[model samples]
Target: MLMAHPAVLRDLVEQYETLSALHAEDGSPESQQRLNDVAYTLCVSTGTRDVDAALIAARHHLPGARVEDDSVLDEEDTPKPPAATSAGAGI
Candidate 1:
């Protein structure tokens, strides 16, 4: 599969994180739209089905990521329930 450059992936992750930190679903439409757009782009770039998986894949592909680090993608790594700031939330 084609992979996005590390720089691009880094930027995408950073952008998504920044937007999420600044806005929620109840925020302005423009911020919400931007968050959704970044999440979609992350999924596409990582060839993953969802933003969470995409984020894992993207982080794994980034520079300095441990190639043998399966832990990052492990189910144990997933956030617990009741959290509201997930990447999939409001997308």
Candidate 2:
């Protein structure tokens, strides 16, 4: 994984900080996307498949940010259908 390289994670962290600052200052969705991408990559580096937990952890570790992981959003109440699998998925 790219994060195995010490510098890769550090570079992403720097980018995340910069983009997050821009998002906070101007409400730029593009900057938010970039920031989220960095967060996602950092989560993936941990080698866990539990994305929700990984995201929460990432938010907790974010520089100068205190994310509320306990709050439930209305959208989360909606039921999501199971993902469709390929024909050979269980073969």
Candidate 3:
């Protein structure tokens, strides 16, 4: 089996955690089961047999890897303030 890219593995791990937290908050039974099925399949189909193993392998392979947080996306969506105009400065 081809080794999974460190970035892809990291994305899956982060997604899984996000889904898990969502499920914990307002999860339905069916949604939980479905999430479990898809999550396990994702782990196995990648290089690792399970989620824990995948996480470990990813960390081992890429020590400096970082999982981007949602705050980055959120901040990008905010509108930037208009630049201040100077009376003497040229446009």
Candidate 4:
């Protein structure tokens, strides 16, 4: 998989976090689901199996942005969760 620029990743993370927080609060289920989907997409875009590599990529592209170890991508080889029944339902 082609890696996205760090800036892109940073933006994605920001958007994901913002949307997620909103989703947790008053956002519609559809909006929350969309945010989750974006985060999942960003995680999968980095082909590296190493979570650190993916995090580094994100940091590289976004200088001054802190990419925490916790932001590492999930196990790429593992099966993804079942599809959501509706927006935000699967997440």
Candidate 5:
């Protein structure tokens, strides 16, 4: 699996958290759309199946991650689903 740059993952995690804090999902259509876009990007970047898992994976890939910290593992320890394709996936 290809891993995203740590800086990029950090930015995505921060962006997603900020949007969530601002209640983007309950805000205007544009805000909700942006949140969804960010969530999807984060998921693809981390090879995770959902937003919650994506956040955890993103943090784990970031700098200073500890081996014993919030470790998540499946039976095979791999991404569960194939990721969706997006032109803006690098975002």
Candidate 6:
């Protein structure tokens, strides 16, 4: 299961809607299609079928809107500790 903070989900939905509205008003079919693609991706990624519910939950958590950097930790940053073995054990 993909777990996402409520706020993140809301931001995506808001962006999707805004893009969709812009597409409709300007008769930009290509932009509208892109927005639809984004919406679909958000839904699938969040494991949510109800886009409205996801949007509401997201808005409640993230009102001001912000972007977060998701970077992977380096191997050096995650050094493994040495393992201990029995001093007197039959091999």
Shift in Å, residue 91, candidate 2 = 78
Give a tens-digit lDDT track for model 1, residues 1-91.
9999999999999998888888645698988898899999999998988988889989999989876677455587765568566787677
Task: Give candidate 6 regions above 4 Å deviation.
Answer: 5-11, 23-26, 60-91
Error of 4 at 84 (Å): 53
Models 1 onward score TM values of: 0.74, 0.42, 0.47, 0.47, 0.78, 0.45
Give Cα distance to truth, residue 84, candidate 3, Å.
65
The CA lDDT at 70 in model 3 is 27
Q: Please give, for residues 1-91, the per-residue lDDT of candidate 6 as tens digits.
A: 7556765676687778888667653667787677767677676656667655455444444546433311222456654668987877886
lDDT of each: 0.87, 0.56, 0.62, 0.61, 0.90, 0.61
Ranking the candidates on lDDT from highest down gives 5, 1, 3, 4, 6, 2
- List candidate 4 stretches off by more than 4 Å: 24-26, 48-57, 65-91
Q: How far does residue 25 in candidate 1 sit from its true spot (Å)?
A: 2.6
User: Could you tell me the C-alpha RMSD of candidate 5 in Å?
Assistant: 16.5
> Over the stretch 12-45, how does candidate 3's per-residue lDDT look in tens digits?
6676777777873368877777667657755674
> Mind sharing the TM-score for model 4?
0.47
Per-model C-alpha RMSD: 14.5, 14.5, 11.2, 16.6, 16.5, 12.5
- Write model 4 residue lDDT over 43-69, tens digit each, in one string: 675654443465455555567755443
Clash pairs, candidate 4, are 6-61
Ranking by TM-score: 5, 1, 3, 4, 6, 2
Instruction: Please tell me which predicted candidate would have the highest lDDT against the true structure.
Output: 5
The best candidate in terms of TM-score: 5
> Which residue pairs clash in candidate 5?
none
Better of 2 and 4 by TM-score: 4
What TM-score does model 1 achieve against the real structure?
A: 0.74
